[model samples]
Target: MGSDGTTAEVRCVAAVPCWVSLMAHDLDVAKAFYGPLLGWEFEPGPDRFGPYVHAVTGGEAVAGLGAASGGWGMPVAWTSYFGTESADAAADAVRERGATLAVGPLSFDAGRVAFAADPAGAVFGIWEGPLGRARRLDLLGAPVWIELRTPDPFAAALFYGEVFRWDGRDPERFEVRWEHDRVVLRAEGHSVAALAREQAGGPAGLPPHWEVSFAVEDTDAALIRAEELGGTALGPAFDSPYGRVARLQDREGGRFAVISAKP
Candidate 1:
């Protein structure tokens, strides 16, 4: 990407959220639910990690959906992948920081990837490969934001900063800031994600996890449609500085959010 983070940036820069994927118990069901909700179409993806498909929108690969393997109790959820120059080096950094490396820096047709958990046990992915397809951020049916809900936002930021080398001078480098009581990660002079403490009234005993939000034409309308598809809304849409957002779970219990600029 150029220093300004414009469309000229063809490849995903290291330390930025490059992709998001949902591992579902049944891939078809996942697709069925999201296709109508997000206006996405599916295309086959590399099968290195089981049956996988890319969720496409407007001729762009927006996200991924994969069938969970060896999974009776596996939590259906969206996982975010951060771009990296070297997955092996990033894995080592994660291990050195008292974190857990859950999966491989395994090779695939596209690139290498690994799954790791932060100190607070929030799982995320590291990818060393081409960005494959450009994402339509903040548009209809596209991912608008990624977030980490943890016990300690500062500690989470520090761990990720070291692992991703956020301070480096790479074109993909990020600027970190504390804003409105949350740690925000910005790239190309725009906010990409945030780290915040788990809210007091959130689901009790739920562990820390990275959350992804998709843009919609209407937040409440999308939320009602989610319920029709067997998904549960954590609550009604609430206003944020950016827009109105509502968290919801898929039929399989995968959590995600839908937001709209209109209130």
Candidate 2:
């Protein structure tokens, strides 16, 4: 059970977000920019997907990058994938909740995978394999957190709760604090992700989306490298309870965050 009286029984059944992938119009430009900025080394994906590239850090696959093609009209951005016991079941649950399946419950050598968009239009994926689980976070270039910024935090929470079996009770359950805009999702008392309502007059031009944050040794230094690599800093680095954080956009305008957490 969870600490706040909500059941944690679903922790074993529902998959946590274990990987993130960035979709880019130009794969070469994406590689050139991220290779230096994040210290990511890329290798070709499995035989099924020829254009896919897996981002490796310290010899382990941490993320993925692939070309955006076909009728994929969304802007270039990172898509977070949750590990699931069965991608087909997860896809059914997403559809039952009124969310649209953007991709497939397609089979691969690694496992099954699918992409879906929430009712608010935030895209995410489901992965079923040992390779789909979250990698160790001891390295500086690993993802530490994922967040959803939507117009309706409450609705987003409810939607994810239904799909992922997350505890979404109101007032006292599953919140870091009642007044906090960010609602944290926990699995066995450990936070896995969060949903935040987009603030009025703040980056409203960007559509509802998921932002993946990678941990760094120094936020200031990382921000500098980002700028040097043709990326733009969305804002100056600032201290938070979690760490020093700054928002950044890739040269192609895909947004992400970097944080140097307090130890």
Candidate 3:
């Protein structure tokens, strides 16, 4: 059991995004930036992945923060984690589907973990362990959505569908459908994520990546707070079909988004 009395053992539904993590150049700095902006507190997490902590809000783990030291030399970015029953098997599927397996299906105190990049070079992680009660997709300050910005949304969907067994999964709980120009993945009748074609060859163009969006009470207020905390608003808050959204970059150049909570 965890210190909070929650069971440390949880079998998360395989192939669903169970957690999200950010590797920052400095752990304290990341905490300081997010603490005030999102009303997040911190708690100790597994150190097997380096100095790591769980970002807690309302006594629930919303995200993870890790210090990007020890010659890791990776970019300071947020990587989304999908839950799996077998980390090694997922890693194998990643390789078989022509994706690059970057890290290990190594064992940690709570569970096994691995990292991989899709064919489009978008990096993501896999965890075979306790999800705790951190998988909140609607609560304020928790990750609400994850979007895949890639060259071809259809092809990307195909790749992920095979890797995660999205097609063969129980349809009542997990479903995928094409909505307009994007491919949407819904868990339990609610939209959890989407894949859309990325912008190309422009100043605003972003590389193929998975963008994580957090829930906020006020989009404009969050952007203002982000600037005051040394983060940049990559773009102004704009209303999407989902909600008012703003893209942001941390002081160290990690990109993420914030969306205002629905009434």
Task: Give the runs in model 2 whose Cα sits over 4 Å from its true position.
Answer: 1-14, 69-74, 131-134, 167-181, 187-189, 199-201
Q: Please say which candidate is ahead in lDDT: 2 or 3.
A: 3
lDDT of 1: 0.81
* lDDT for position 28 in model 1: 90
| CA lDDT, candidate 3, residue 164 | 80
Using TM-score, give the best candidate's number: 3
State how far residue 199 of model 2 sits from its true place (Å): 4.7
TM-scores for every predicted model: 0.89, 0.82, 0.92
Global CA lDDT computed for model 3: 0.81
Per-residue CA lDDT of model 1 for 33-116, tens digit only, reads: 999999987777777678888777766667888995666568788999899889999999999999999999998766798999
Residue 172 in model 2: lDDT: 32
Ranking by TM-score: 3, 1, 2
Error of 3 at 124 (Å): 0.7
**Would you list the C-alpha lDDT of every candidate in the order shown?**
0.81, 0.73, 0.81
**Which model, 1 or 2, shows the larger TM-score?**
1
Please identify model 1 stretches exceeding 4 Å from their true place: 1-11, 70-72, 131-136, 170-173, 199-205
Compose the digit string of candidate 3's lDDT tens values, residues 159-245: 888778787777787889887478998887778789988754323466788889899999999999999999999877898767889
Candidate 2 lDDT over residue span 1-263, tens digit each? 22222221111114467778888878898999988877888776653553567776776667778885565666778988877777888899999999999889998755788999999888898887743223445556767778888889888877876776554433232333223457776544445577888843456356688788888889999999999999999989988656788899998988899888777
Pairs with steric clashes in candidate 1? none
